[model samples]
Target: MADAADGARTPAARLRALLAAAPADGPVLAPGAYDALSARLVADAGFSCVYMTGFGTTASLIGQPDIGLLGAAEMADNARRIAAVIGDVPLIADADTGYGNALNVARTVDTYERAGVAGIQLEDQVTPKRCGHMGGKEVISTAEMAGKIRAACEARRDPDTVIIARTDAVATDGVDEALDRARAYRDAGADVLFVEAPTGEADIEKIAGALAGGTPLLFNWAEGGRTPPLTLPRLRELGFSLVLYPIGTLLAATAGVRSLLETLRRDGTPAAALGSPQQMTLPGFDEFTELVGLSAIREREARYS
Candidate 1:
């Protein structure tokens, strides 16, 4: 296993470097990974960073929605495993409302930092928080959310570990209120500010205009969600530092699986699906084994033998 001490940059350090080197006029696109294999795939595809989506993780792990079904420990363990596999590739994990209050936020930060995440995102949703893009979302008071951000900042062991504050106030209060909450979060020591589920391009531009110069802002390019989808160039033009595609891969995988299952049911075989140009080719046995580190395990076994 590759350890951080094996002449490798720590995950936090790598993340910090990526953030520092990010193009001032463009955004760093970090795609979400639900598991260790997905994280490795993200790194292999040459992404500078990876985002751990709570929605994807919950769906992949337990076939559940992103409605606060997973607790802090479960989320942290998933993050730890993903970080271990992706070694040195900075992981920005979703730490959803810190699972409770300000003290809970502190513990959540501590857990994520210890789990090797480069950044942890905390939202301002109420306890048992639903997805930001979902309806009927309500956010806590701005002062309370700001206090949680402060707690998260204070609990970080590594100064480079980013504290991202996400405000879901747009759904409840309005864009103006959301922007206000973001400013408060930034004042409370949030390293990155995210205004969740901004409905239109105008609001997106407003978020960047208001928050971009002072603090690094995050844009969510949520597919099939409330937010209007914008190109990377456009988002960068708006001055977003980090852009997260939280469920693109997950949704793609879901579609692929559904297609394969439908084809199998119709033909009673995978031959047609495998041969289709639109379908992804299945990995060979050797390639799949190597992907999971069979070669490294074999080398260790040989040394023992």
Candidate 2:
């Protein structure tokens, strides 16, 4: 839990401080959280930040894949909820394609800043963007994306609120095009650069070698995705500043739910599920109650009464 002084600071300010103070050798690791509960778990587990993954959010909310089904309002509302629950922990949210053009991009940035997100990731894919690792992805022109980046940067009320520009050109065009777009986005005032879904170690190295040291580089460690699962030390050595384990918490929670349902169907009790290490493990009842802030609620009630 964050102390009083930490809690008093704005999420954006806290995030800026964290970035400024982080060691070059150890990049900040932000785990994906699908909802308020999952975000709370991430915060309680002591992560420096929590990432609001559009993929997991789409799946959790609508039982659908992340093919840009949800609109800007839905994403912003989810970000507000997640930000509320995780006190003092910075939220880096995915603002897919900024929902439209430059004007729309500005509105998205404003809405996200008001939602208390510390970082907003804008990708170069079309309006209806898919997951970075998925096939059949297409990107807009470099000049268009650069304009959107400028819009996003100009729209933020808090200057410290990070504008992360992600280029998916690796899937559509090639690694060279992706690198060129990244440079353009960086020149357009993107605080962080995300070259999404590099296929191998060579691609990753090329990205770091080309774009690192000037602006922070973000690595998306999407589990079971196109990118190879590289270690933290390796990414740090490459000068990457952040790594997002998007969808890991969602996958873990999904597996736990499946196990519990299976145990109930087979044994007619949750007892066996809790008894084995291989089965679903849940926190104790009181432990979870406290984790979700029943203690704080009770304290407030007592003060009022």
Candidate 3:
């Protein structure tokens, strides 16, 4: 499961496997990882795939929200690092609005394909991203998003590289419009349908059935997003193949860092309560001997020979 050398195995291959395995299973979990270390941790924890979260990356890197602060270059570098440490785990990325118009989407598809993402979820929210299930959401015309979808489909080098179309129309237009957009995107060659923020179970069931067993489905489990919370089993029963728990890691890490800082400030000494002497856990010390063990072994062999 950890090998990255098999020519026949690709991120797209892993994604297809998940699509095939979705039926009659718990919702496929794609926890968001902000950086290389977290990606490795997630892969090692036995997740089938990892999500390169935009919100986490932005806030952790520059202390900002998903308000479209990180540009294409930053996102690309982050994705490259994430792909590297996670080995060959399928990465489902957040390509927020393809980072621009249709032409930009075309380039994005090519770039992300080269970056080795198994699939990408493209939203219709006009740039300066608003949460998919949140208030004050703006959406592009169905025709425009449809055009972008077509561009992405055509730009990809691998046919199996999934193109997921996500719409914020549910809040802006209504369930009917969102469903309409999903149908149109499906017709435009999208592999998966993401009618984001369906308000209730009824609409969720409606969307699940609307695909007519054609393409796969995706959902976001944003804690405060417009969509009502549901259990993993419930989401699976509703026929969703992929679920993204984005921002959870960043939120947890933010909370922990703040707590540690508060403890240090209040006690005037974090060393006594948290880490070793001076409460800094050796503060910035990294033990490298274990990391270089293989290098040491190689050097020893050369010396001996």
Candidate 4:
């Protein structure tokens, strides 16, 4: 894993510092990025952190849905690329079901930590898990999930590398069952608790009320997902310490690409849409190059020459 600019503090240490002094007004907002370019965009936009969304990764990498299609190696390689580009910005990655049983989870944790992710979210969903918002999801037993959490905790070399425990019990069982599962995960040594896909605002509040005030809580503000969206202040008041806007970037990029393709096909030119308000919002050619660190590359080349 690459060190921060100081060359001493690792990305995990920076994330731990952020958590230690996190504000009460709002949870850390981690926007999802599918590739190194999108990860750079998130960091350049001044966000302190970025998230590697499994949904976006599966979509971008294989043009498939997030159906447990990709394995540990694929996810870790993508994490490495994003981590390399983002420099000091902490990355929180989704390690789906830890790719297998308790032993697999341990290896997944070690691999992701080495890949430079500051946090790894492991869910209780059964193997070959689909998106939390999607139907036909199932969760493993509480004991089994707790065992996974312990294995993850034991496997990480950096104690600051957070192990986030997510429960898909709300979909399979009920909110109460989800809360119970979350509590068990916490007891099993999870650094953060994530109860995935609460269908209503009431359920959201119920989750925070039940599991908050002890371990740090995570909220998934996944765009167009099953969970109802809430304002940051409301989530803060509900006691969430981290909020993930997973899939928003992917959704917006998809819409933008589709619109451009339609314009090109119809008008035989993209000039009409190029200067439109929507396109105007995008960065220009030179600005994008600078954003991607062309200046830094040029400086290095000049030094060598």
Best by lDDT: 2
Each prediction's TM-score versus the true structure: 0.93, 0.95, 0.86, 0.94
Error of 3 at 165 (Å): 0.6
lDDT of each: 0.86, 0.90, 0.80, 0.89
In model 4, how large is the Cα lDDT of residue 258?
94
lDDT of 3: 0.80
lDDT of 2 by residue, 1-305 (tens): 23421643688877766665444336878999999999999998989899999999999999999999999999999999999999778999999999999999999999999999999999999879999989988889999999999999999899889999999999888899999999999999999899999999999999999986768889999999999999988887888888999999999999999998999999999887777554436776776798899999999999999
Q: lDDT by residue for model 3 over 1-305, one digit each (tens)?
A: 22321343777877776776677455578888888767776887888889988878887789776778887778778888888767678888889899899999999988887887888889888987765655788998999999999999999898889898999898889888999999999999899888888888788878788764868888788766667788888887778888888867777767777877888899887664456644454333334333324576888999999
Q: Candidate 2, residue 212: CA error in Å?
A: 2.1
- Runs of candidate 1 with Cα error greater than 4 angstroms are 1-8, 276-280
- Where model 2 places Cα greater than 4 Å from the true spot, the runs are 1-8, 23-25, 276-280
lDDT value for model 1: 0.86
- For residues 1-305, what per-residue lDDT tens digits would candidate 1 score against the true structure? 12221333677766655555454425677999999888898888978789999999999999999999999999999999999998777899999999999999899999998898999999999989998888988788989998999999999898878899999999899899998898889999988889999899998888888876757889998888999999888887787888999998899889989988998999999887677455547665677899889999999999999
Ranking by lDDT: 2, 4, 1, 3
lDDT of candidate 2 at residue 49, scale 0 to 100: 92
Regions of candidate 3 where Cα sits further than 4 Å from its true position? 1-8, 272-305
lDDT of 1 at 139: 80
